[model samples]
Target: MNESNRKRGVLSPCAACKLLRRRCAQDCVFAPYFPAEEPHKFANIHRVFGASNVSKMLQELPEHQREDAVSSMVYEANARVRDPVYGCVGAISSLQQQIDLLQTQLALAQAEVVHLRVRQNASYSSSNSHGGFYAASPSNSGSPPTTLPASSRGKAIYNMDMVFDQANMGYPIW
Candidate 1:
């Protein structure tokens, strides 16, 4: 009768009625309909040629193809799962600070080594001039060296006979 009613075919509804401003009738799920709509060009083409179609084709394939498809999916998932997880910015920055601290310590150690080397060279230069820094080698000089045997349990041997020499030093008239 009217332009809107004439467009209403045997219970097919418009996109607007089906989706929004919900109202329904017995014949159509959503009323106030339109009919003989042309299919969306891109959506139809995608349905025929896209990944969904490819997946369907794979599903209908032989056993080896199906296994290959599943394995590829699993491999992709594993790669995503096993990827090295990066820490947050703060953690990474803290690690960098630790590295910087270690580098500074290394530099300090290197400087100390250089200082020690310089001191060693200075001592070597002064060794003959000043009789510097006694090294306890039996071949060179000095008093008898003390050595500990395995049986000596951290005790030093003192010569008590020298301490008692005063007693024997008294008058010897005989």
Candidate 2:
């Protein structure tokens, strides 16, 4: 009614009226949910579900549920437009497959790390020589070959385990 809000003013026609080529009533059902700027969004919806059917469906729903129903229809319509054969299900299946692959890859990486750690620990326990993954101290490796204190040996293994856990899991184990 105001001068600024005249025909096709800042308020463009709702998508349904624009598509249907008619005046959008003051109480147009589509106005609140589908704005004029997003013509394609409603176009996709209209293409998938006919205008009359959409109107009837919206009318059947309670006021509170209409917004959610509109959103679901729009999403499904878009998905159907993208992939007519399988629609949203195709997209969901593809994402699930990718997740499954990444999980398998993570499992393999974890197992390989555990296997390497076991071998390295075995070498550390068996070797008198200093040349191993868990290196002996220079003082112990050299001529006198002094035995390490119990606490020192425990700390070395603990440190190695901590490093291994951090590398594999992105956090300290203990």
Candidate 3:
């Protein structure tokens, strides 16, 4: 056979053909994607999707899209093997739960930081003024201080209220 024919496995059967116990024709759909070296790739796919179904699927798609389709099929087949029922969905759900837990922890940490900053500012102003006794000013009483120190005024402050609100609204913060 010629070089192109040899590459197409006219001489040696492709993985799919070898697994199926059939000869690999020059026009075999599985030849390019399922080379002879990676028999396990086609084995899992065949066990999950079946050879006839895969052949039909590949034949229906354009040549340019076949490789990607095969890759997706392989991934799905592997996932299905690992998780018979939920497959990739189970992995995704676990990751999402982790994200939610981390976000909650982050929000709590941010609130604590805001609380500490307010307390520090309160103490600093008190110590500098009325003999270590906190005299709540008219602008500061009954509410948290909105104005930051002159050194911190130009920096972006984390608004814990907005973060809590967004967290309550079921949206991701980061």
Against the unseen true structure, what C-alpha lDDT does each candidate score?
Answer: 0.41, 0.71, 0.78
Candidate 1: segments with Cα more than 4 A from true spot: 1-87, 130-174
Pick out the ten consecutive residues of candidate 2 with the lowest summed lDDT: 156-165
TM-score of each: 0.27, 0.67, 0.75
Whole-model lDDT, candidate 2? 0.71
Tens-digit lDDT track of model 2 for 31-131: 77887777887898899999989999999999899999999999999999999989999999999999987976775566567555544544556455545
Among the numbered candidates, top lDDT falls to 3
Worst 10 residues of 1 by lDDT: 29-38
Give all candidate RMSDs, comma-separated: 26.7, 8.7, 6.3
- Superposition TM-score, candidate 3 onto the true structure: 0.75
Query: TM-score winner among the candidates?
Result: 3
Of the two candidates 1 and 2, the one with more favorable lDDT, higher being better, is: 2
- Looking at candidate 3, the ten consecutive residues that score lowest on lDDT are 138-147
Sorted on lDDT, best first, the list reads: 3, 2, 1
